[model samples]
Structure formats: C-alpha cells, structure tokens
Target: MLSGIENAINSVFKPISDAVSGFVFAEVTVFGVTFPWIVAWLVVAAAAFTVYFGFVQFRAFRLATQIARGQFTRPDEPGEISHFQALSSALSGTVGLGNIAGVGVAVTIGGAGATFWMIICGLLGMCTKFVECTLGVKYREVHADGTVSGGPMHYLRRGIAERFPTAGGRTLGKVLAAGAAVMILFFGIAGGNMFQANQSFAQLRNVTGGDDGFLGGDGAALIFGIVLAVFVGLVIVGGIKSIGAVTSKLVPTMGIVYVVACLIVIGTNITSVPAAFGEILSGAFAPEGVAGGAIGALIVGFQRAAFSNEAGLGSAPIAHSAVRTKHPITEGYVALLEPFVDTVIVCTMTALTVIIAKTQFWTDAKATVAAGGPTPDGVTVTSESFASALPWFPYVLTVAVVLFAVSTIITWGYYGQKAWTYLFGKSMLSERLYHVVFCLFVVVGSVLTLGSVLDFADAVLFLLALFNIIGLYLLAPVVKREMTNYRRRRREGEVVRVK
Candidate 1:
C-alpha cells in the first residue's frame, strides 16, 4: 500500500520534477569538466561577496564572535530573539544530515580532496551570509505584536525598492519577492520537512534492525511521523521565540555531542590523522581515478558545501533577522559564523572521521558508482564508519539524525509560515492552516519514497538562490554602508558592550 502511494505520487510529480531539475541543474562544461551551472552560480556569488566585503569573514571573525556572545546586544532591541538564539536557530536549520551523510557522499564521489574544497567553499560562503543577513535585518518587518518577518522576500522587495525608488524598482522587487516566497514555501515542505522526515525514519529503521525490528512494521513510520510532527508543532506554534529558545539550547548540545563523538572516533585512530590529512590535501590537487580529476573534486566539494551550509540560499537570513540588535550588521557578523560552524567545523569533522576510520564502505561505494549503480546511501556509509570504531555508535547516530531532522523541520516551519503569511494574510486561521498542512506533509514524507518529490524540492531550493543572489547583489551596497557605519560606531565607542 505504501509503495503504491509512493508510486502514485511520483507519477503525478515526475514530469514537474524533471522539468525543474533540467532548468535548475543545467550543466555546463568548463575545461572539459561538466558540473551544474547552479553550483557555479552559487560559488561565483560567494566569491564575489568575499571579495566585495574585503574578506569580512576574516577581518570580522573576532567581532562576530563577540556580538554573537551578546557582548554588543542591548536588552531593549526591537527583535524577538538574542544574537545567540538567532544564530542557533539558523545553525539548526543548516547543520543536519548534510554534515553527516552529505560529507560521506562528497568523499565517496569526489574523494577526500573534496573535503579541502568544502572548507574553502564554506569560508568564502561566510561573506555571502554576512551580506544577505545584514539586509534581512535591515529590511525586516516588526509587527505590532512584536513578531519579526524577514529573509529574501523582505530584503528583495523592500531593499530593491529603496535602492531604485521608482515604479520599475517596486515592480521588480514584488516579482522577485513573490518568486522567493513561493520557492521558500515549496522547498520548506519538500527539502526541509519531507526529506528530513524520510531520512530520519530510514536511520531509525536501520538502527532498529533494518526490517526485522518492531519499528519496521507497516504502521511504524506513520506513528513516528505523527510523534515527530507533534513535537515540531509544539515548538513552531509559539513562533520564532519558541524556536529560538529551543534551538539555542538544542543546537549547542547536539553540536558539542556530535563533535565530541567525531573527536573520539578520530582520537581512537589518532595515528591515522596525519595520513588522513595527507590524503585530503593530496587528493584535493591530484585525485587518482576520480572523475573530472581535481575539478571533479572541486565541483563536488562546492556542491556539498553549498547544500550543507546553504550560505547563498538566503534561508538563514530569516532566522538571523530575529536577532535583538539595533545594528543590523551585527547580525550579519554573527551570521558569518553559521557556515563556519556548519560546513567548516562540523562537516570537516565528519569528513575526518570517515577518512580516519578507513572503513570498507568507501571501497564498496566507489565500486558501485564505477559500475553505474545508484549512489550508496550516505547515512549508511557514515553509520558504518562510526560503527567501525564503536560497534554501538549507530544508535547514537540515530538519535543525532532524528534530532537534526526535528530541528530542521521546526526552523523551516517558521520559514514556510513566514512565506505563507507573505503570500496570504497573516490571520490566525491562515497560520494554523499552514502549520496543519506542513505537519501533514511530514507524515506523508515519512510514509513515502518521495523520489521525484525530493528532486523537485531541491530544484526549487536552488531556484531560491537565483532570486536571492540577485537581490543580494543589488543590495550589496546597502550592506556595505551599514557595515561601515557599524564599524565606525564601534571604533568611536558609540556601540555599547554589555559583556
């Protein structure tokens, strides 16, 4: 019955998925290495932002840390959440399966060399986050009820109009903003909610004996989905404040736990550390037997980094916009830390663990790919790597995966709700209806394969970067002006420090 349902859904959606995928992932060959044009688009934008901002990721790294720690935050700020909470909310959205499974996929396809490129892409992406998030705060709407709504929709519409201040500018802003909102809502359901739910269920089922356990029963997934949705609904019903509070605690605890687990795996194989680093560095430049050679690795790395940290996608700005800060650029500075933590630190740790563990999963995955077989499941490969060290670690990984999924779902719930309100009126009925529909999709995602559905969602997600990056470029000057003023104020002791 579940298989039939999945097939029916796929039948209805496959054509739509194929069309969007073709357009969004159109490939272009550069120097005989073919890769998605969208990946290059995102990388180019990040690179441009990095250069345009004078490497703000480096110059303001310490300042970002200070501001995120609440050192420069005032209690009377208008936004709903503190700097740390806002960062945590944003981090929870990005630092999920992408860090664990996605890294495994990267190394399997692109070799260990991909890890090097992932780090580099993540570093460059910091500036993109800085730019977009600055404008998110700058153009956000603070409602009479004190709720904040922002992201690419707000920035694209309002920032663009403010920049041009003409009828044409306003029309362009509205069109771009509408496109962004629609894409956000679509991806929030498909990628953020459904994909996470499906993967989390897969991980749970695997850990529970892979079709032999009680959870492998026909109705188990439905039950799991409902329970998950209930938890998410609880948090999201309270809106961003509730999400901020939960994520502020949950993100740090989960991150520290995951990082420590990775450290243990690496520490147990301490002798292999130097050799693993050597493989990463060497493979990055001259990978043997890998497709597209170094360029292949670079493409894979950039793709994974873009997918994992999502710096240019403009989703994080929504969460960051809720930060309680008078100076919008402070949140931008805090935002830069997101890609660093998600891709640079967490993802790098996962990659290092997989490399140091030296599991047979890699060899088998590579062989399967060479034979034109479907890519091996990333979660499985990652689980095998952890289990190679601690035989019981897969259970821990299950917990991590589920937590990651729930956190991602709730953050995206807020994102989608904001988009829904943007499109429809923000009445209580509309908000509740959106939440109900969102949760239903969570159940649907858990019960179904969602093959083409996921592809469609991913395509829409990248499509968001199209509208968002264009808006970012148009508003880059605004961000720079804000940054200049903030820096000048700080230097003149006009910005207060509480911590």
Candidate 2:
C-alpha cells in the first residue's frame, strides 16, 4: 500500500515535473561543457547586483556585522525577531547538506579547480542576498495580532505595484506574486522539509547499521520520522519566535562543532594545505585534455556555490524579513554575510578537506566506479576523506549531519509556513492544519523515494528567482533612492549609532 501511494504520487507529478525540469535545466555549452542556463541567469543577476550597488558587499560588510550585533539597532524596534536571530535562522537553512555533500561532489567531479570559481560565486552572491533581503523587510506586512509576514510574495506584489502604477500596476504584481507563492509553497514542503528529513535519516542510518540498530528494522525510517516529526512539531508550533530561538543557538553550535572537526582533520595533515591550493588553482584553468576541463570545473564550482549558499534563491529573505529593525537596509547589510559564511568559509573548508585527503582510499572505490561498477556516491567520498586521517571521525560527522539537517528543517518550516499563509488565509485553524501536514511530510520524506518531488522542488525554486529578480529589478530604483536619503541623513548626523 505504501509503495502504491509513492508510485501514485510520482505518476501524477512526473509528467509535469519532466516538462518543467527540461526548461529549468536546459544546458548551454560554455568552455566546451554543458551547464544549466539557470546557473548563468543567477550568476548574471549576482554580478549585476554587485556592480549596481558599487560593491556594497565589500564596503558594508563591517556595518553588516555591527547590525547583526545590534550595534545600530534601536531597542524598541517593531518586528518579530532580532537581526542576529534572523541571520541565524537564515543561515540554518543554507548551511546544511549542501555544505557537506554538495562540496564533496563539486571537488570529486569538477576536480580541484572548481574551488576558485566557487569562491568568486560566493563573493558575488553576497550582493544578491543584500538586495532581496532588504526588500523583504521593506515591504513586509504586520498583521493585527502583531505577527509579521514577508518575502518575495509580499515584495513582488507591493514593490512592483509601487514602481509600475500606470502600467497595469498591482494586477501584474499580483500575478507574479501568486506564481512565486505557489512555487515556494511546494518548494518548502519538498526541498525544505522532506529533503532534510530524508538526508538526516540517511545519515543516522549510516552511523547505525541498517536493520541492525535499535530503530533499524522494517518500517524503521517511518518510525524514526515520526519521532523526528514530533520533535520538529514541538518547536515550530510557536512560529518564528520559537524557530528563531532554537536556530539562534543551534546554528552557532552546529557551525562551531563542524568547523572545529574540519580543522582537526585539516590540521592533522597541515603540510599538505599549500599543495592543495596549488592543485585547485591549476585545476580551475586546465586545458581541454584534462578531466572535466576548464569549463567543467568552472560550471561545477559556480553551480555548487550557488546551491550551497542559496544567495538569490529568495528563501533567505523570508527569514530576514522577520527581523526587528526600523531600517530594512540594516537587515540587508547583515544578510550579505550569509553567503560568505556558508560558501566562502564552511564550503571552502569541506572542499579543502576532501581535496587534501589521501587518494589511498579511492583507489578501489574509483576503480569500481569506472567499469560498470556500483556508483560510489559523493557522500561516501566525503566519509572516506574524513576517515582517512582521523579514522574515528565518521561518528562525529554523523552528529554534525543530523544537527545540520535539523536546523535547516526548522528554518524551512518557517519559510513554508509564511508561503502557506500567503496562499491560504493566515487563520489560526489554517496554520494548525499546515503544521499537521508538514509533520506528516517529515514521516513521508523519510520512507519514500518520490524522485518527482525532488525534481519539482528544484524546478519551482528557480521560479522564485524568476519572480523575485523581476521584482528586484523593478524596485531597484526605489532602493537606490532610499539609500541616497539614508546616506545624506547619516552624513547630517540624523541617524544615531545605537551601539
């Protein structure tokens, strides 16, 4: 019966998913390698935003850190969470599985050179996050109950309408906003919720023997999912405040633990570090004769970096929108740090660790994979890299993976909730029902394949960029105007330094 339901779900969605996937993942050959044009679209937007803002990512980074520390924020600000909490919650979403498995894949397939392009993408993505998040806070809605809601859905509608009042105005904005909401709503459930549950359980099962551990028997995944769901349900019931409080601590703890463990592995083989950097730089621009070649490396690096940080995916804005601040740009300033921390720092660590690991472990694994042998997945490669040096680090990795997955799940729950409210009315009953369904997906995600769901989830998220980028383009002038006024006020001593 369960298998039937899973198949049925796939059957219904597969056709639509296939069509969407084709368009979304359409390849354009560059540097003698084919990559999804969507990657190019996102990178172009990041570059454009960075140049338009006069490299605000570099100049405003210090101010961003200050805002995150509450230095420039008034105590009596009118929003749901603090700037720091908002950053934490948003980071929890981006700094999860992508930082681990995704980085490993990029290095393993794209080769060492991919790391160079990855850093470049990370730097540019910071500007993209700044633009969307600033608008997220600027156009948010505060309900009568003191709860605030925002994101691409709000800004695309409110911001776009303000810009094009004489040219179909709100009607056009509503169309784009509605489209983005529906896509993000689905993305939240599949990519955000189910995907997290799936990976977290997979990692747990890896540590504990399959069908041998306490909860590893038949229906183990389902049972584990139920318990996990209950835990997540408990935290999410209180809304953003609840999620924020948990993620604020959880993100920092998980990050420190992972980074420290990575350092231990890297530090053990400290002498190889310089050589690894050399390989990365040379690999990035290798001649066509090289494996994956220059283009392949660049494509791999940019795509992985984009996926890891999710700078312009428009999801972070939802979390940043809830920050307590009189100045929306303050949150924007703080948000620019997300890509740097996620990709530039965390991802770089993962890539270096993988690149520097002894090839002794991959001799047989790569052989098996070369000749119609069983596929050795990237996650396995990552595990082998850690085990090569520390020998006992897999246990530590299991804990980090679970924590990263959990943190992302909870943050995404908030994102999905807001998107849900955008489509369905924001009623108490409506919210409770959404929560119940979300928890149920936690269970479903653990037990099912649902490949179509993954495809659809990925496709729909790019649609977020479609609507979001359009809205950002329309509102760019408004943001520029406000920025000018803010600068003038600061120069005139009208803006106080709360710190």
Candidate 3:
C-alpha cells in the first residue's frame, strides 16, 4: 500500500519535476565539459560581485569578524536579533545536511579536485552574501513593533524601482520581485522543509542499522517527521527572535561537535592526510580522473557551494535583515561569514574527513557518472567515511543530522512565511495556512522519494536567483553608494564602534 502511494505521488509529480529539471539542470558545453548553466551563472555572479565590491570579502574580513563578535552592536539597535544571532540563524539554514551530504556528492562526482573549486566558490560567494544582505538590511521595512521584513522581495521591488525610474521599469521590478517570492515559497517548503526531513530521517535510519534497528522500520519516517514538526513548530512562531535565539546556540553547538568529531577521526588517520590532499590537488589539475575530469570537478564544486551556502539564492538576506545593528553594512559584513562558515569551513572539513577515511571512496561519483548510473546518495558516502574511522561515529552523525534538520526546518519556515506575506498580506490566516502547508510537506518529504522533490526545489532556487540577480544588477550602484557612505562615516568618526 505504501509502495502504491509512493508510485502514485511520483506519477503525478513527474511531469512537473521534469519540466523544472530541464531548466535547473540545463547544461552547456564549455571547454569540452558539460555543466548546468545555473552553476556557471552563479559562479560568474559571485566573481562579479567580488570584483565590484573591491574585494570587500577580503579587505573587510577583520572588521566583519569584529562586528560579528558584537564589537559594533548596541543594546538598543533597530532589529530583533544581534548580528551573531542573525548570522547563526542564516548559517543554521545553510550549513545543514548539505555540508555533510552535499559536499560528499560534489567530491564524489567531481573527484578530489572538486574540493579545490568548492573553496574558490566559497571565497567568491562571500561578496555575493555581502551584496544581497546589504540590500536586505538597507531596504528592510521596520514595523511599529520594531519587527523587520526584508530580503530580495523588499529590495527588488523597492530598490529596483529606484534604479529603473521609468514606469515600465518600476512595473518590471515589482513583477520580478513577485516572481522571486513565488519561487521562494515553493523552495522554502521543498528544500528547506521536506528535503531536510527526508535526508535527516534517512541518516537516522542508517545509523540505527536500517531494516533491523528498532526505529528504522518501515513506518519510522512518519514518526521522525512528526517529532521534527513538533519541535520546529514551537520555535518558528516567535519569528526571527525565536528562531534566532534557538539557532545562535544550536548552530555553534552542532558546528563545534561536528568539527571536533571530524578532528578526532582525521587525527586517528593522520598518516593519509598529505596523500589525501595530494589526490585533491592532482584531481583538480589532471584531466584523466573522469570524463572532462578537471572541468567536472569545477562544475561540481561550484554547484555544491551554491547549494550549500545559497549566497546568490537571496535567502540569507532575510535572516540577516533581522540583525540588530545601527550600521546596515555591519550585518552584510557579518553575513560574509555565512558562506565561509557554511561552505569554506564546515564543508571543507567534511570533505577532508571523507577523503581521509576511505581513500577509494573519492572515485565513487566519477565512476558512477562514467557508468551512466545516478548520482549516489551523499549521506551514505559521508556516513561510511565516518564509520570507517570510529565504529560509533555514525550515531553522533545521526544526532547531528537530526539537529541540523530541525534547525533548517524552523529557519525555513520563517523564510517561507516571509515570502508568503510578501505575496499575500500577513494576515493571521495567511500565516497559519503557510505554517500548516509547510509542516505537512515536512511529513510528506520524510515519507516520499527525493528525485522529484529535489528537481522541483533546485529549479525554484535557480529561478528565484534569476529574478534576484536582475535586481542586484540594477541596484549595484545603490550598494556601492551605501558602502561608500558607510565607510566614510566610520573614517570621519561619525559612527562609533560600540564596545
């Protein structure tokens, strides 16, 4: 009966999934390598923003760190959460299963060389984060109660209009913003809620011994989904404040634990460290690992980085906008840390662990692709790597996965709610309905297969990026002006750095 339901659902959604996947995964051959256009577009955007901002990600790195540490924060700032809280909240959304599973997938498909490119993507994406988040805070609406509403919708609609003064231009800006919101709504549910639920549950099932584990039986998913929904539903209600408070703690806890565990495992296998890195470097530059090997790695790296940090997706800005800071640019600076922590640091760590533990596992993706098989599940690859080192590590990973899923679902609920309110007014009914649908999808995701869900969400993410990048291009001058004035104010001693 369950199999019948799963098949029916797939049959119904297959067409829609196929249509979306066409655009999301549309590939173009470059230098004898085929890759999705979305990956190239995002990588180009990241590099462009990095250059346009005068390498703000590098030059302001120190200041950004100081600000995130609350050096520039005041108790009575304009928003609901501290910069650290905001950063953690956003990081909570981005640094979830993707780091564990997605990184493995990238390295698997692209070879060890993909790890090198993934780092580059993260560095370039820092500027992308700065741009979108600066616009998010700059154009955010502060309510009577001191709440904030911002992100691409607020900036694209309002800032884009200012950039394009003509009536038609203004109309186009609103349309683009609305289009992005529509996509955001779907992605928030699919990727943020369901995918996390499904993947996290799968990880749980794995660590528990799969078919024979007490909680790993056929009906375990529904139970896992309900538990996730209950915990997440409680926190998402208080908006960014509630979510921020939870994430500020949760992000650090999980991050420290994961890092420490990886460190121990890597330490246990210290002999292979140099050789693993050698494989990474060689795979990156050598062209014989797989078909279009170096190029394949490059594509996988960029694609995974974008998926992991979501710098260009314009989602982080929503959470960053809620940060309490007198200087809007502070949060932008703080947000630069998002891609770094999510993609640069956490993801790199995961890759290192996997590469070190199971040497032969590095070729899984290339081998699979070369054989015309589907991309393997990253969770399995990552779990096996950890298990190889410490027989008990999968249990730790399972706990981390569940925690990551819970945090992601809660944060995404806010994102979807914000998007929903952007299109429909923030009435009680609208908010409640969005919550209900979001929770329902969490359950659905846990029970269903991921092929269709992933394709649909991936498409939605890229479509929203299209709308968002259009606005970013139009509003680039404004971001420049804001950054200039902000820097000048700091130089002239007009803006005091709060201790």
Candidate 4:
C-alpha cells in the first residue's frame, strides 16, 4: 500500500520536478567549467554584501557576542525570544545533516581543498545574513497577541513599498511576497518536515541493525513516525517561545557533544593533522584527479556552504526576527554568527575528521564519481570516518542524526506555520489545521519514498532565494542606515546596557 502511494505521487510530481529543477538549478559555464547559476547567484550576492558592509562580520564580532550573551538586553523588549534563543533556533534549522553528510559529499566531489573554499564562502555569507535579518526585524508585524510575523514575505511586501512608494513598487512587493510565502510553505512541508523525519527513521533503522532490526518490520516506520511527530507536535504547539527555549538548550548541548566527538577523532590522529592540512591546500589549488580543477573545488565549496548555512535563503531571518530587542540591528549582529557556527566550525570539523582519519569511504566515493557512477551516500561516508577511530561511534552518530533532525523539524514547524498564517489568515482553526496536516506528512514521509516530491521541494527551497535576495538588495540601504544609527547611539551611551 505504501509503495503504491509512493508510485502514484511520484508519477504526478515527476514532470513538475523536472521543470522546476531546470529553472532553479540552471547551469552556466565559466572558463570551460560548468556550475549551477543559483550557486553563483548566492555567492555573488554574499560577496557584494560583504564589501558593502565593509567587513562588518569581523568588526562587530565582539558586539554580536555581547548582544547574544544578554549584555545589552533590557527588561522591556518587544519580541518573544532572547537573541541567544533566536540564534539557537535558527542554527538548529541550518546545522543538521548538511554539516555532516553534505560536507562528505563536497570533499568527495571537490576533494579536501573544498574545505578551504567552504570556510571562505561561510565568511562572506555572514554579511548577507546580517542584511536580511535586520530587514526582517525592521519590517516585522507584532500582533496584538505579541506574536511576531516576519521574513522575506513580510519584508518584501512592506520594505519595498516603504522605499519606492509607487504603484509599481506595491505590485512588485505583493507578487514577491506571495511567491516567498508559497515557497516557504512548500519547502517547509517537504524538505524541512518530511525529509528530516524520513532521514531520522533511516538512521534509527541503521543503528538498530539495518533491515534485520526491530524497527525493520512493516509497521515499524509508521510507529516511529507517529512517536517522532508526537514529540515534535508537543514542542511546536507552544510556538516560537517553546521552540526557542528548547533549541537554546538542545542546540548547545548537541553542538558541544558533536564538536567534542570530532575533536576526539582529530586528536587520536594528531600525527596526520599536518598532512591533512597540506592535502586540503594542495587539493584546492592543483588537484590531480578532481574535476574542473581549482574552479570545481571553489564551486562545490561555495554550494555546500550556501546550502548548509542558508545565509541567503531568507529562512534564518524568520527565526531571528523573533528576537527580543529594542534595536533591530542587535539581532542582525547576532545573526551573522550563524553561518560561522554552521559552515565554518561544524562543517569544517566534519571535513577535517574525514580527511585526518584517512577514511576509505570518501576516497572510494571520489573514484566512483570520477568514473561517472552514482554519488555514494554522504551519511554513510561520514559514519565510516567516525567509526574508523572510535569503532563504536556509529551508534553515537545515529543519536546525533536523530536529534539534529528533530531540532530542524521543530524550527521549520514554526516557519511553516507563519507562512501558512500569512497566506490563509491567522486564525486558530487555520493554524491547527496546518499542524495536523504537517504531522500527517511526517508519517507519510517515513513510510514512502518521495523521489520527485523531494526533488520539487529542494528546487522550491532554492527558488526562495530568487525572491529573498531581490528584497535584500532593495532593502540594503535601510539596513546600512540602521547600522549607522545604532553605532552613533552606542557611542553616546543612548543604548541601554543591562550588564
């Protein structure tokens, strides 16, 4: 029955996925090497924003840290969550399998040199996150009930009209805003919700003994999905406050454990550290077997960083906009650290672990790709790397994977609810209905293989950048002005400092 449902859905959605993929992942050749135009689009935007902000990520790093630690917090703030909670919630969404599996894929295709480019891209992406998150708070709507609604949808509609104030501007704002909302809702259901649920179940099954485990029975997936959904529904029912509170605790604990695990692996192979760094540097510039040489490594690195950190995807701003602060720029300052923590720190740990351990999985994966075969499973490769040292770490990796997926699902639940309310009007009935439907899809995702459905979702997720980056470009000046005002006020001691 599940297989039949999967086939039916795939048949219905395959054509749509093909069409959307063609547009979203369109390729362009540069200097005889081809890469997705969307990757180039995001990379260019990040670079432009980095220059426009005069490298604010570096200059304001201390200020961002201060704000996140509640140094500048006041008793009476407008938003629902603290800056740290908001940042943690956003990080929970972005720092999932991408940091683990995605990095494995990058190093496999682009070699160890890709890690260098990934770090560089992560740095540039910080400014793009700053600009969009600032605008999110600036244009957000705080309802009578104290709930916040924001993101590209709110900013594109409100910011564009405020800046241009013409019929053309109003029309453009409405169109773009609707497009963003639809994209968010679609991706939230498929990629954010279903993909996480599906992957979590897969990891559980793998650790329990693969196809011979207790969770490998016919009804096992359904039971697992129901249990997972129930846990997720409990947290999300309380909305952003609940999500923020849980993620504030969960993200830090999980992040510390994961990072510590990576450190242990790296420490065990301390002798290989210098050689791994050499391989990373050499593979980046003058690789022997990697495709398209240096340019290929750069493209793969940038793509992985963009997808993992989601710096320009406009989703993080939704969570960041809920931060409690009088000065919107404070949250923006806090927002820049997300890409750093995600791509720079977590992802680099994964890459270095695989490289330092001299894991054969990635080497075999590279050979397979070079021979025009299917890319190997990234999660499998990453797991193999960790297990090479610890021998019993696959169980730990499975636990981490499940926790990461649940955190992502919880955050995205908030994101999709906001988008649903934006389109269908904010009523109790509407919100509850969305939640019910979302949980049902969680069950469906676990039971069935949604091939084209996931493909369509992935494409729509990137399509969000099309609407979001345009709005970010238009509202860059507003963010700059806000930064200037905040700095001047700080200089005069006008901004309150609780600590």
On TM-score, the candidate that comes out on top is 4
Tens digit of lDDT per residue, candidate 3, span 316-435? Answer: 899999888767778888899888998889999899898888745545555777787788788878877888877788788889998998888888899989999999887779888877
Ranking by TM-score: 4, 1, 2, 3
Model 2: residue 145 alpha-carbon error in angstroms = 1.7
Cα error of candidate 2 at position 52, Å: 0.8
Q: Rank the candidates by lDDT, best first.
A: 4, 1, 2, 3
Point out where model 2 deviates above 4 Å.
30-33, 289-291, 361-376
Q: Give lDDT tens digits, candidate 1, residues 1-499.
A: 7788889999999999999999999999887789999999999999999998899999999989999889988799889999999999999999999898899999888888999999999999999999999999999999988999999999999999999999999999999999999999998988899999998998889878889998899899999899888988899999999999999999998899899889999999999999999989988999454645688789999999999999889899999998888899999999999999999999999999988887987888877775677778888788888888889888898899889988999999999999999999798899999999999999988888789989999999999999999899999999999989988997899997887
Cα lDDT listed for each candidate? 0.91, 0.86, 0.85, 0.91
lDDT of 1 at 109: 85
TM-score of each: 0.98, 0.95, 0.95, 0.99
lDDT of model 4 at position 131: 94
Q: RMSDs, each prediction?
A: 1.3, 2.0, 1.9, 1.0
Model 4 quality (TM-score):
0.99
